[model samples]
Target: MAWKVLIVDDEPGIREVLKDYIEMNFEHTKIETAENADTALKKVTEDQYHIILLDIVMPGLDAFEFLRRVKDLNSLIQVIMITGNSTMERVLESIEAGADDYLLKPFSTKEIEEILKCSFARIERWRNAFRNSF
Candidate 1:
């Protein structure tokens, strides 16, 4: 299966590294980038992504608020919130904002692999349910 992914962050280097790492490690996956929450919102609305790596800090639009708005735009996408800060407050906030998972900025490769595995498994389950229903 070809999985579609989106990486949203204000830092170019973060986006580049994430894109490279995910691409190199994951097969049959296409990844897109958005520099800001505004662009992320637009992309999420116009496209379908199985997983979204979203930053907690962004200029112009607050990431938390963006996550909140995302619920209305599309709830099916598995959004994994990424942040430099690993405070319990932020984790709670991310959960409240509907993030499927939360990862620190310097997360290990294994962590991402696990996140992807779980997210894809969820997609597979949904697909199986739909196919069985029909």
Candidate 2:
């Protein structure tokens, strides 16, 4: 199945690495990117993304707030918070706030693929539940 994935980060390098790895590994998956939360939010509002890979520290909105807003907007949107600073507090906060998973930055390609597998599995479960609700 073709899925839509959004990568939201302030650093261009991080975004490029993620985009390249994802495109290389997943065929038929469409990847889009946003440099900051503002642009990401705009993209989220305009389009429906199956998965969102978000950065923690950003200019306009922090990952915590962004996750809250996006979850409220659509609970079906699966968000994975990625950051270099993986403090225990922030990890707990992201999970508590409804992030599907938290990934530490500088992740290996294998790690990225593993996270993608897990995220996609969760998304499938959520989608099944949503369909059952009807």
Candidate 3:
């Protein structure tokens, strides 16, 4: 299946690295980038994304807030929070705010691949369930 993914982060380098790695390793995946929460929100409304890689330190609207908004917009969309800080409180907060998963900053390509694999599996299951319901 072709997957649509959005990478939202304030740092251009993080966005580029993620985009590059995913593009290089994953086939038939469409990836987009947003530099801030506002732009990310606009894109989320405009497009259908199976997975979103969102940063927790965005400049405006806050990352947790953004995650909640994204969940409101599409409960089926899986959001994986990206953070430089790995505090337990923040991780718990993200999960409580409706994030599907999270990745620490400076993550390896292997980690990204693993998380994406899990997200894709869950997405597939959701799609199948929706189809069966119809």
Residue ranges of candidate 1 with Cα displaced over 4 Å: none
Q: lDDT per residue, candidate 3, 1-134, as tens digits?
A: 79999999999999999999999998999999999999999999898999999999878889888889899989989999999989999999999999999999889988999999999999999889999999
* Residues 1-134 of candidate 2: C-alpha lDDT, one tens digit per residue: 78899999999999999999999999878999999998999899999999999999989877788899999998888899999988999999999999988889778888889989888888888779989999
Which pairs, if any, clash in model 3?
A: none
What C-alpha lDDT do the candidate models reach, one value each? 0.89, 0.91, 0.94
TM-score of each: 0.92, 0.93, 0.97
Off by over 4 Å in 3: none
In terms of lDDT, model 2 sits at: 0.91
Off by over 4 Å in 2: none
Q: Per-residue CA lDDT of candidate 1, range 19-110, in tens?
A: 99899988999999999999988888888888889999889889888888887776767889999988999999899889999989788888
After TM-score superposition, what is the CA distance of residue 134 in candidate 3 from its true location, in Å?
A: 2.1
Best by lDDT: 3
Question: What's the candidate order when arranged by decreasing TM-score?
Answer: 3, 2, 1
For residue 22, model 1's alpha carbon misses the true position, in angstroms, by: 1.2
Error of 3 at 21 (Å): 0.5
